[model samples]
Target chain A: MCLKSVEGIVLVVGDNVDTDAIVPGRYLTLTDTRELGKHALEGLDPSIPGKLKERNLIVAGRNFGCGSSREHAVLALLGAGVKAVVAESFARIFYRNAINRGLLVVEAPGVSQKVSDGDRLVIDLESGVVVLASGETLPFKPIAREVLEIIEAGGLIERLRKELQYGRG
Target chain B: MVNVAMDSLTAKILARASGRDRVEVGETVVATVDKVMIHDVTGPITLDLIDNLNARIPKPESLYIFLDHYSPSPSIPASGIHRRFRIFARTNGVINFFDVGEGVCHQVMVEGIVKPGEVVVGADSHTTTYGALAAFSTGIGSSEAAYAILTGRLWFKVPEPLYVRLDGALPSYASGKDIILSVLGILGQEGANYKALEFAGPGLRTLSMSDRLTVANMSVECGAKNAIFPLDEVTLDYVREFNTPIDLSSLSYLRTAKVESPHLTLDLSTLEPMVAKPHSPANVAPVPSVEGVSIDAAFIGSCTNGRYEDLLAAARILKGRRVSKDVRLIVTPASKRVLMRALQDGLIKMLLDAGAVVTPPSCGACFGGHLGVVGDDEVIISSSNRNFVGRMGSPKAKIYLASPVTVAASALEGCVTDPRRYLG
Candidate 1:
């Protein structure tokens, strides 16, 4: 369940990336996560996916994902290889979805200003550290211990499986 | 602090939750769920989570499931959700299952399922529409919704209440949609975040159930839990038409819980048709007051304004005329029942003959997820809630919120214009 830590620069955005902007209303029926990934952030900037194929981090303002409670938005970001998302705040649903899928989402209040696009950065969720290529290190309040356990176990389903198995003995 | 009438469902819910203290920004609270509701889109997901949790359903009567979106349009996935919902309802012995053509979820729940002074959680954000009937309703995620179904309890941090008092009678062609948009314009998009909008005063008496529902439906756009109105004979009569042998036991509880005080009032007699301009949900203006704006599309639907009255109003304006060649008009009914009634009354025909494309009763263009999405640089006049940038399709697209008459008129004019001229 361990994921490879991804490193890159940060792209800051404001609150609320609604579903219409995530994949557009036209492609809602498209269940394929891969195809949906290509269109992620296409609403914000059409070039986000092409740039993300190389690797990047998204730093957003408060309430980063605020519209419809669609899991597709998180799936699209994860499928696009978005290593981590640092935002002042995250929508309750989106935050849970990202954690359940083992995606790294950090709440760094001033993180949006500390990093700019193309400023190379490194994120280590395991170490609870974000290292800017500029040699500056920022520490984040780690997720709840139980949540980290679930993320480390790959997701809720996997964590539940392990818990059930342990209980069976 | 001064006292105010606690007649609003929001006030009652808050009063009941006052013991829990405040739920600060970025904090969580878990409270017992008094009731749970779900619609077609989120129902299947919620049921899946419930099954995965392996929790036996409790108090089936308190769980309400409605098939409003995509009713009778039955795509494979939709059909699958419907089938699964039926199986789940029967196996779990749920009593409040309303199938296709029953009515919109929000309307049906308030009229039949939701009781006064109770906490209700639904998977759909518009579930807050039920607050109009003196109940505390809010939207939750599928996982949380599943948790509610499992334990008959969910967590909620107590939210502060925002009091909006309306005093005067509403002007002609001015509806609750305008009132809410006007309020949203005053209060920015997040002005009432995590708060309950307790709507009170004489102005509420001038509005109908449909109108009240419209106001409550859009409360989410402002990030409030719900906009609630006190229950009166108007609400009770509406409910009586749908359910028989009314229970009077709760009436005494409702009366004993009343808190009386002076109200802050908003006079709406001088109000005009309000519109939330595109690029942002909070960018609103009066229809006649705005000018120099053109439109490429016009839509009327969604849980907010897709009711029978909304359609009839649109039809009244659109009958015997055609939409402008440059304008694409799309209309979707909120529920199959509304669609059937519209069809029976020739409202659908009038819309179609007037060049409106009638679609199935799905969420449709409201979320900009599917059906009638505007293109880049396109400007649309819509009756649906929220005009956030890129909410209807392309980020470059613009959405203008207005009444059904305004939207219908705009479709005929190919621009954003006042509907009063054509109506008269």
Candidate 2:
């Protein structure tokens, strides 16, 4: 289902938070989702995954999820209970993977600059707004229509399943 | 003036793949993939999703499953994936199931099967490597690959094209690794985001098939969706050498092919041996600039630099010299085919005589799987693409990306050193 808004504390990170750093190659063989989550971002900080509580969000710099076309990186983040990722921009493959998996990835050009680590923010996917505790709001491009439909269907797996059931997309 | 009407080679390839006269940038098209590949790392997960779809693939002949990464069965997981992939391929009638040690997915494609004017996609991002053959190839995630497996098609947003023209012949000491690292340096890591890098120019003749593949393989480092070289006599001869009894002379697209406008030219001859310092591929510099930087290990393999010529380059430097006692050297041929050829040519014996460990035909140590994993406090010089943190071993270990020549040279000295003196 498409979440109209997400309210959570942000775990801020720098630019080019690539896939290998998100989920390093050594542990890539462990295809289990929960195990991958426990080791997520171990390259950057081994403790990051444990810090991610339910509905927590990640606010990162430009080109988040850069490098590697592996969906394991996205799965790791989602498996750790990350509600959404708001970055200046995203690597194309990661963006598509996130959308297909029904994960919320927002591109807010100055989102990182506006929020510090531990800042509670309310992000509206439908309207593309990020509201900080101080009442400051950042505008972003709203989720695309077709992508919203995928999110509404609980991801591409469900969407594809529906298509197969009905005999069309 | 903006050439809004200029369609890229990527566009043309898409147009042909989709059965249309033309496809433009930003248009979504259902591209018919000429071939697709999935390795051990991602293939099992893709299989799970494919099982969900429960769609019997019609053209099983076009799909290729490679068991390269962690091959030789590093652990039970890798072995299980291998077994599953074997069963899946056999049951589905897929002919190109490359078993353990066959080679990397990219090298396997280059050895044969991949052709010009084709659209290829693989689960691995380095799938862009096949574009060296003038095919429009890009990397996609396993979800997309799963969809492609169910059907013979996948949708793509025809990316904007970035033309990178090479000028002047590179010095013999400088290999394709230097050329590509220099390109990555100039374009940072994300300069070509969501774009296709089309390589076309007179200087293209200076590179070998492996060299073109080397440059094309790392196109994803700059965030390009695809990278391609136009079909010429060099590529034609290379392709024909493997796919015998097929007439390449009858192909029309090879003769009239050309990339569109909006491009930049790079002078190849001026480039020196280069390296990308940790923890990203874009942080590139000349070898001399980073000279004397110590290393704990030297790796000479990956889809980017594990061809016969790459091993030959390293063999030239280590013919009689022993690797530094403090340094460990690991060489992995891109494929079992390359390893066998190198063995017949005595490259493997020479490396072993010099105290280097030669692993099986697999993607090892490049992404820190096994064989020569660096320590937390160590530094490494590798011919593999990508030097991201924790890419090789510990996140604390630094990786320096270089050509096989530099890797061999540095392996002997245990530090980053100029390769000119080692070159013949």
Docking class of 2: medium
**Tens-place lDDT digits, model 2, residues B254-354:** 44434334367788888889999988899998889999998989999999999999999899999999999989999999998899999999999999999
Model 2 stretches with alpha carbons more than 4 Å out = B1-6, B244-251, B254-262
Best by DockQ: 2
Best by lDDT: 2
lDDT of 1 by residue, A76-111 (tens): 887787878888767555676677666688877677
Residue B103 in candidate 2, Cα distance off native in Å: 0.8
What is the clash count for each candidate, in the order shown?
7, 0
Residues B329-379, candidate 1, lDDT per residue (tens digit)? 999888777888899999999999999999877666776656687788989
TM-score of every prediction relative to native: 0.81, 0.96
